[model samples]
Target: MSFGFFNIPAPVNEPVKEYRPGSPEREAVKQAIATFRSQEADIPMYIGNEEIRTNQKVRLAPPHDHQHTLGYFHEGTAEHVNKAINAALSAKDAWAALPWEHRANIFLKAADLLAGPYRARINAATMLGQSKNAYQAEIDSACELIDFLRFNAKYMAEIYAQQPNSASGVWNRLEYRPLEGFVFALTPFNFTAIAGNLPAAPAMLGNTIVWKPAYTQVLSANVFMEVLKEAGLPDGVINLIYVDGPVAGDIIFNHADFAGIHFTGSTKVFQTIWGEIGANIHKYKSYPRIVGETGGKDFVLVHETADADEVAVGLVRGAFEYQGQKCSAASRAYIPSNLWSAVESKVKQFLSEVKMGGVEDFTNFVNAVIDERAFKKISAYIDEAKKSDQVEIVAGGNYDGSKGYFIEPTVIKVQDPAYRTMCEEIFGPVLSVYVYEPSYFDSIIKTVDQTSEYALTGSIFAKDRYIIERVSKALENAAGNFYINDKPTGAVVGQQPFGGARASGTNDKAGSALNLYRWLSARTIKETYVPPRHFGYPFLEAE
Candidate 1:
C-alpha cells in the first residue's frame, strides 16, 4: 500500500507532577502503593504470545522495606532465552514491514497511557521495587518515560523523511531500514525511565527486541510491559525474560541472527559482552552493533568565586539523591581552600536535615540502598575511609542493615587527590572531597580530568565568567554532560541529550536522533531517466 507522506505529532516534554501533601496525585500514588502491597502478584516472562511461567519463583521486595513481600516473578532457564530470541526473529519481518506511522502510533498511545491511567501504578512500582522517593519516581517513571516514548516517535518520522537529493533527469531515494536481526535491551535498575527506553527505543525504530531487565527492577518492568501491550504493541515484538547474564549472552552473542544490543549497566559487564561478541564474530551473518552507557565517577568542581551556598546545594542534591546510586551522581568534589569551610558547614547542615527510611514516607529525602550486596559494598568503602588516616569523615558515616539497607550520606575529606575513594566508582551515597589551594585551580582542573577513567557527567560553579569559560574549555572532555552552578544529575530528555564517553559509554546521546540511528540501516536507491550503453563511455570513442 502506498500513500502520501505523513507527520507525527510534535513532542513536548511531559510535565513533572509535584506530589505535595493532600494533592490528588499524592493521594492517588499512596492509594496505588497500598493496593500493590495488599496483593501478591504472580509474574511471567512474555515470550511471543505466551506468558511463560516456570514454577521457579523469585520473591520481590522493596529495597527500603525488605521484610515485606511484594510478589514473585517466575525465573526462566536457558531455554527461555533461546525462545525469546526465536520470538524476536519470527516477528522481525512483519514488524519492520508495517507502515512507519502505525509503529509511531503505538508508542504515541503508550505515552498517553503512561501519562494518564498507568502513571500512578508505574510510579508506585518504582518507589517500592527500586527504592525511589515519590518525587524521584514522578520525574523518572512518569515524566521521563513519557518523554522517551513521545519524542522517539517524532524522531522516527524525522529519520524516515530524510531523503537524498535528486539530480537532473534522475531520481534518488534513501530508505531507512530496520536492522537485519534482533536487538537485545539489557537494562538497569536505577531509573524506570531508562529501563523502559532501552527496549522501547529500538523497537520504535522497527527492530524487534529481547528485553532483560535487572532482577531488582522486575516489578516496574512488568508494569511497563503491560503498558506497551495495552498500547497495541504486537506480541513477540518485545520479549521480556529473566535469566542470568552469562546464560543469555552465551546464546545471544553466538547466534547467527543476533543484530545489536541496547545496554545500560556496569562497565565491566559491557566490556565482557563486547569481548564475547568479538570472539563470536565469525559465527554471525553481520557485525552486531554494541551500544552501552556504563559507570561514572561524576564530580563537582567549586571555584573560590562560586557561591558557597550554591556549591553546597549542588553537592547535596547531586551526590545524595537516589541514595547516590545514579551513574551521573557526583561522587567527588574539588573545593577551593577558601570556600571549603562554608561549603562543608552547609553540606553538613543539609545532611542533618535529611531523613532516611522507606519510600512510603514522603519526608525521607534519603532511602535504602538497593539490597544487601550494594549495602555491603558501599559500607566497605566507608569502613576503609574510617580506617585510613589520609581521609577525614566530615559527616554521616554510620550504616545499619538490621531492618533495611540504610547508609548515611557520608562525606570524606581526602588529603590526597588520588585517594581510593576519589578515583573509584562508588555507586552509593558517599562523596569524597579534596580541597585545593586557590592558586592551584589550574592544576586542580587537570587533576579532575585525570583522576577517573569515567567521563560521564560533572559540573563547575563559579561567579567570574572568564573562569567559567576557562574551566569549561580546560575540562571540555572531562564530562559528557556538563553543568554550570547546577547539580550534575537530573538530565531532561529533549533539553539535554544524555550519555558519556571514555569508559562511561559510547557517547551515543539517548534523547536525540543520534541514538535512534544506531538501530537503523540505510539503503540508497537511484534510477536514471535516460538509459544508454553505460559500459561504453564517451571518452573511449572521442579521444
Candidate 2:
C-alpha cells in the first residue's frame, strides 16, 4: 500500500511563553481564565464516539477557591470501565493496521493545534484545575506537552526505520508490531504534559488506549481529548473515562485482552497493581508490560566550595516551585556547615518575599496544593518538626485551609541526617536541611544515596572539578537524572530524557526513543534467495 519512505517534520521544543506584564500572552491567558470561570461545564466520560453521562455527578472546584464551583464530571462505574475496554479492543486492529505515517501525522497535527490555537485555553484549565501558577501551567500544559507530541512522532519514525543486517544470499528484515491488546494509561495530576503523554505515547505507536486520568485533572484532560479529536484521531482509539481506580483495575487486570499499562502515580498503588497483574497473569493472552514512575524523595547536595547565592537560588526554585508537587522537587538538602549560615539567610529572605494565593494573582509565586489531603499530609510533617527539639523551623511553618488549602513554603533544619522529613516523601512545599561537616563529605554522599528508596532525581553543587567527578561517580546510582549545578526539576524533552530506576520507575526515558520501544514487539524475517537442493549440509558430510 505504501511506495516510499516517509519523513516526519523535524522535532523541536516549543518555545515557552513568558507571561510578563504588558504581554499579549498574559492578557490572552487572563481572558481565557476569566472565560472558563464564567461557565459551568458539564463534563462527561468519552467512550468511543459517545460522551457518556451518568447520574453520579462529582462537583469540581479550584483548589485555591474551593467554595466557587467550576463544574461537575459524571463519574463512571465498573460497567463503564468494561465498556471502555471493549471500545479500545474493538478499535485496536484497525488502528494498528493503519500506516505508521498516518498515525504519526495525527499526533503531529495535535501538537501544532496545542502549540497554536488551544495553548491559552489548556494552560488556563491546568492553572485553575491543578493549582499551578501561570508560568508553571505554560511550561507544563503548553510547552512541555507540545514537545512530547512532536518528539514522540519523530521517535516513532526512528523506531520503524531500524532494520536487520543480512549476510551473503540471505535477506533479513525487522517489523515492529504493536502490542496484541489495548494499553491502559493511568495518568497523574501533577503535570498536564504527563497526563497527555501517558496515553498519547502508546497511541502514537499504533496502539489503542484506555486512558484514566486523575479526577483533579479532568478539566485539562478534556481539552486535550478535544485537540486529538480535531486532529482526526478516530473514535475508540483512546477512550477517556473517570472511574474509581480499584474498580477499574479489578475488571481490567482480570481481562484476557489486557496487554500493558503505562502508569504515573504513587508507589503503593503501582505495587498493588503489579501484585494484581501477577495474580491474574494466567488469565491474559501474554505477559503485560508494566511501566511506571512512582514517588520520589529527591535531594540537593551543596558542597563547601559552591557559591552561596547559587545554592540559595537552587533551593528556592527547586523546592518551592509548583508548591513542590513535582516528583523531582528538592525535598531534602545536605548543606555543608561552612555555607549553612549564608544559604539559610538567603533561603529565609526568599521565603519571606514569596506570596501565596490563587492562580489569578500573577504576583503570587506560590499557590495552594492539589487538595485537602495533600495539605494535611504536608502540614503534619511541619507540625511534627515544630514539636521536635532536634529540628528547628528556620522559616515558614504557617498554614491556613479555611479559604484554601494553603501551606507556607516551610524549611526545617534537622540535627539528625535521617530525620523523618528528610527520608519520607512529603509531596508539598516543605524542605528539610541537614548541615554536615565538610570533613564528612564522602560519608554524606553515602548517606544521601542510602537515605531514600527513590532514585528519581538529584543535584550536587560544587565549583571544584575534582569533587564533582568524585561525587558523580560515588553517587552514580543515587539518581537517574542528576545535575551538576542546576536544580533537579524541569527536565526538557529532547535534552534530559527523564525517568528513574530502583523504586522510582522503569527508567525507560520517556522523551527519547527508549520509551517508544516498550510499546512495540519486534519480529525478524529472514529470506534466502537460493535454497539448498538437499536437506543434509555438505560440510557435515565432508567432516
Candidate 3:
C-alpha cells in the first residue's frame, strides 16, 4: 500500500543545510545551542543529598545517517544505588519534619525554574537527544512539566493543610504525616510529565525518594534534577540513579527502609515487582505502597452517528503522535460498519497530512522512534499484520531504518477484533481499524474490553447522549481515563486522575489527590481534658 493516507501529506524530508556555528545562516542554531549549553553545563544528578558526576559525556542525537551509533548511558553501579537509598532513608525523617509551607515554597521555586529558559533548554536537549519533532518534543517535555509543577504542588499543599472536623462536646482532630521511609520512583521515557509526577508528588508530601528514570530518556531526567536543584529543593529530598532495572529493583525492594514504589512501564515489569513485594511482604517493617501505570490496549469506539472528521483528528493524533509510543495511544479503533466508509476515508485523509522528519526542522510533524529496538518492534508488528489473511492495509505500513528510526504512520483494517493487532498493545504507529455490524455492537464492545490485559485508557466518539452514556458505562472497567470525542493521550492534571486499576496499573492516580495520598500515612491524635469519670468495668472504676 502507498504511504499516503487520503489527503494527508507524506513526510517531506527537506534536509537541513550544514553551516558553521558563527555563520549568518547558522545564527538561530548557534543561539539555541548556546542557550542549551549554558543551562546544561552544570546539570546535577542527585544521589541522595550529594550531587555527583560520573564523567559521562552527554551526546546529542547522532546524525540521521549514523544509524549504527546507538547511544548508551554509564549506568549507576549497585553500590551507587545502595548509597543513594541509604542517604534517602537517612534524610526522610528530617525532611518529613519540615513544615508544609516550607516544602511548598521549595516546589514553587522549582516550578519557577521549570517555567524559565531552563525549560526551553531542557526541551531542546530532549528534542535533540530523543530525535523528537518540535511539537512532539515540546509537548512531552517542557509543557507537561509546567503542568505537573503548577498543579501537583498546589494540590498536595491544599490536601496536607486541610483541617480536620471538630465536634462541639468532644474534641477530635486528625493529622496526616509522611511515610517513614524512602520511596522508589521508576519512570518511563514517553513523557517528561511522568518524570515529574513519579518523584515530586511524594517529595512534596515530605517523603524522600530515589528515582530511576528509563534508560532511553536519561538526559531529560537529568535536566529535571538540575531544574529541581536550581529551584532550591533541599538535598536528599529526591535522589537519582542510573542503574539497570533489575539491579535497582534489588537495591530498592530489599532495603530495610524501602517504603513505596511509583512506576510507569510494562505490565510484566509491574507484575514482577508486585510479586517480589509479595514474597518479601513479611520482611518489610510495614506494608509498602506499589503504584504503577502499565501497558494499555487503548481503543477509540466510533459510533454510526459520530462526526467523521472529529474521529479522524482523534485517530491521527492519538495513534500516530509520538510514533504511537504513549501508553494511552489509540491502537485499536472500533467503528460501526454503517459509517466505516466515511470514518475510514476521513482517517486516511488525516494520516496523509502527517509529516515526519528531524527535530530541528520546524515544519516536521513526527520524527524518529526512540531507538532501533522500538523501531524494529513496530516493523515486526506491521509485518505480522500484513501476513494475516484477515486484514487489509488501508494506508501505510512501512519502515526505513537505513537512516533514522522511522516508520510510516500506519493504518490497517482488520476483519476481526480478535486479531492479534486488535488485541495486543502494539505501542507504535500501527492503527487497527475493525468494522462491526450494528447487531454485534454490544458484543463487540465486550470483546474489545477483554482484548488486552491492560485497561489504562479508551475513548468513544458519539453525539448521541444515550449511546455515549451506554458505551461509556460498558467500557467503564476497560480504562481508568475514558474520553468522549477527544484524544486520550493528553490528560490534564487535577481534572483527570491518570492511571488504571486491575492489569493496567496499581491505581496510583498520578495527576490527582490520590497520588499525593500515596506519599503519606495518616496518624490519629485524640485529647481529653478529663479522664473517664467511670469505667464500664468494675476493676477500672476501683482503680
On the 0 to 100 scale, the lDDT of residue 130 in model 1 is: 93
> Taking the tens digit of each residue's C-alpha lDDT, what string does model 3 give over 170-281?
5676578888678899998878778777898888888988888876677677778877887777778788887788988887788767889989998999999999998888
Q: Better model by lDDT, 1 or 2?
A: 1
Worst 10 residues of 1 by lDDT: 534-543
Please state every model's RMSD to the true fold in angstroms: 1.0, 0.9, 9.5
Q: Where does model 2 exceed 4 Å of error? A: none
Q: 1-543 in candidate 2: lDDT tens per residue?
A: 547788888998999889999999999999989988999889989999899999999988999999888899999999999999999999988999999989989999999999888999999999999999999999999999999999999989888898988999999999999998999999999999999999999999889999999999999999999999999999999999999999999999999999999999998899999999999999999899998999899999999999999999999999999999999999999999999999999998988899999999999999999998999999999999999999999999999999889999999999999999999999999999999999999999999999999999999999999999998898888899999998899999999999988889888888889998999989999999999988886678653
Candidate 2 displacement at residue 434 in angstroms: 0.2
Segments of candidate 1 deviating more than 4 angstroms: 541-543
lDDT of all predictions: 0.94, 0.94, 0.76
Best by lDDT: 1
Report the lDDT of model 1 for residue 542: 64
Clashing pairs in 1: none
Residue pairs with colliding backbones in model 3 are 5-348, 8-352, 8-353, 9-352, 9-353, 76-242
